[model samples]
Target: MTHPAAPARRRFLISALSACAVGGLTTSLTACATSTFPFIPDYYTFSQKQVQEAVQRKFPYQRTVSQVFEVALMHPVVGLLPDTNRVSVRLDARLASPFLQQPVNGVFTLSSQLEYDPQSRSVVLRAPNVENVSVDGDAQAYTQQINAAAAVLATQLLTNYPVYTFKPDQLQFAGVTYEPGTITVLTNGIRVQIVEK
Candidate 1:
């Protein structure tokens, strides 16, 4: 005769098998869902156009040089330097002074390295250097003065200027505090990696 516990053992085995089958189905469904929806990283990217717009907000900047000439900087065009991990801005400049018969139109290009400022929770441009300056019409008379003024503007005005500011919510994720760490310049944009604090 079969053992008394034989039927009970068979019932337990069948129940365990049924539970395993359900668990397997659930695991398979989860795997498929994960495959379809990839995980996102903790990083932020700003396109060239977005950066350009951010830089443009500061303009048109005006400065008086030597209590004489007035320099107006406007229409900023931003470009990314991936190799150096820097940003370049070209601005349309207009110079007006009593010494000159008419206002002079010119352009100045400046490049700067970016740094994160914890106090302000923002990415700022630092140590901006005016790469070049050129004027239209017969403005050669003031080239030297114009170059000097451009240098001053790059330092006094653009330096330490915030390119992007992090919102309070952006720095916090999943109950953990994160801050911007490595900033990389890409061909078409800028990438900021966030790290736990």
Candidate 2:
């Protein structure tokens, strides 16, 4: 025969389990609906390799200077200048002209600060300056000419050239529109801060 209190005990246990189950369900639903990951980033990041690849896409660029000398730029080596908040590109340059018996090779170094161009919706090189030009072999006679040509190349070829572009999805998050704000050059790559519109 069952104890006199067994039925009452079973009823109490059932009520307690039901209450616990309901509480657990409520907690689980709330967590699933209202929680977001704490580590989600507000800004987008680009690695050094990605920046290099983006810059590399524009090479090997070629242009004829003064209708006589042909300047072909290739093999870009990109470096981040965190101190000046700029980026540098050292390119291998080949110059050919009828005045020269053979083509002359040199290294052309250029640096520029980055800016967000609203028209282009891109991070572009702005006010590019020719840092240095070093010609190989006996091209001393053409040093001044080469330097001038390098300056032209830096201005004409790279100015307003895009290093990165924000995709449509990248500019939107959680039903909010965000645009790239301050851009910073770091030791390894670039950091673009995004702000809501």
Once superposed on the true structure, which residue ranges of model 1 sit more than 4 Å away at CA? 1-40
- How many residue pairs clash in all the candidates, one count each? 0, 0
Q: Which candidate is the best by lDDT?
A: 1
Where does model 2 exceed 4 Å of error?
1-40
Q: Cα lDDT of model 1 overall?
A: 0.82
Indicate the worst ten consecutive residues by lDDT in candidate 1. Answer: 28-37
CA lDDT, every model vs. true structure: 0.82, 0.81
TM-scores for every candidate against the unseen true structure: 0.75, 0.76
Across 52-97, the per-residue lDDT of candidate 1 in tens digits comes to: 8789999999989877779999999999999989999999999898
**What's the C-alpha lDDT at position 195 in model 1?**
77
lDDT of candidate 2 over 26-110, digit per residue (tens)? 2322222213322223466677788789889999999998787799999999999999999999999998887788898999999
Instruction: After the best TM-score superposition of candidate 2, give how far the Cα of residue 4 lies from its true spot, in angstroms.
Output: 35
Model 1 Cα RMSD, Å?
10.7
